[model samples]
Target: MADITGIPPQSIDPDQALWPNAGTIRSSNQTNAAGQAGNAEKPTANNKDGIYVKDRLEDKDVKPEKIIFSNKLEASTYLKLQQLATYGGENIQEILEAALTAYFVGKEEASRPLPPKVLAVLRKKYPFL
Candidate 1:
């Protein structure tokens, strides 16, 4: 015959009788009281002197500045120019202007098409052209 409690036979020990007050059990009311106490100890509002508050203010102050340059190579060239200027005792602004001018001149030269001979070879290889 099966036990009316619906518990498995192996789980129940016939040698030891079950007591009503044996193991530790917590009620729902006790858990709610503990949760309320923990919540009360937690901070309700943000602290003005906190790291997050300082970072927010710093972020607002950081504005992107306008940078006028022809290309990435021009910027890189400008850095090299600055280094040369340091060694030659010239000003950074002067070096930057010279680099900018050289970049523009080189760009203009590169924009022009190849000569007729080079164009003929390219055309032979690429039918679409």
Candidate 2:
């Protein structure tokens, strides 16, 4: 194949390979003037996994960690959610959180203090309470 192409496949010396991050994905957040990421060669605790982006907290801009949650909803329900978001000029997350908060608050209003006897039994069963 090399002879047909008139080019030879030269072996690469690992130590002298330029652009160390040539094949790895890199974000715009971290890159040197040479377009190579700075810490690709070393595997630190943060870079141990495949994720190689800089820690946002290190930049003094902390954001709440978000966990992905998803469930199948009816097509109508999904469409309504999108329409509500657009109408309110808010994302579905904000709308859903607000709705859940209101629901919890409404449910909490129905709560009544435990009876003395029940409280006594609970206290006896669980001293911490």
Q: Which candidate is the best by TM-score?
A: 2
Clash pairs detected, candidate 1: none
Task: Score every model by TM-score.
Answer: 0.21, 0.32
What tens-digit string does per-residue lDDT give for candidate 1 at 21-74? 222122235555344432323233347564443234342322334122344557
Residue-level lDDT of model 2, residues 1-129, one tens digit each, is: 698998888889784485344333233234332454454444335555554344323532223353335689899998888666545545566677787777778575547778899889977766655
> Using lDDT as the measure, which candidate wins?
2
Model 2 off-target regions past 4 Å?
Answer: 1-62, 108-129
CA lDDT of every candidate: 0.48, 0.56
Clash number for each model: 0, 0
**Candidate 1 off by > 4 Å:** 1-82, 106-129
Q: What is the lDDT of residue 103 in candidate 2?
A: 79
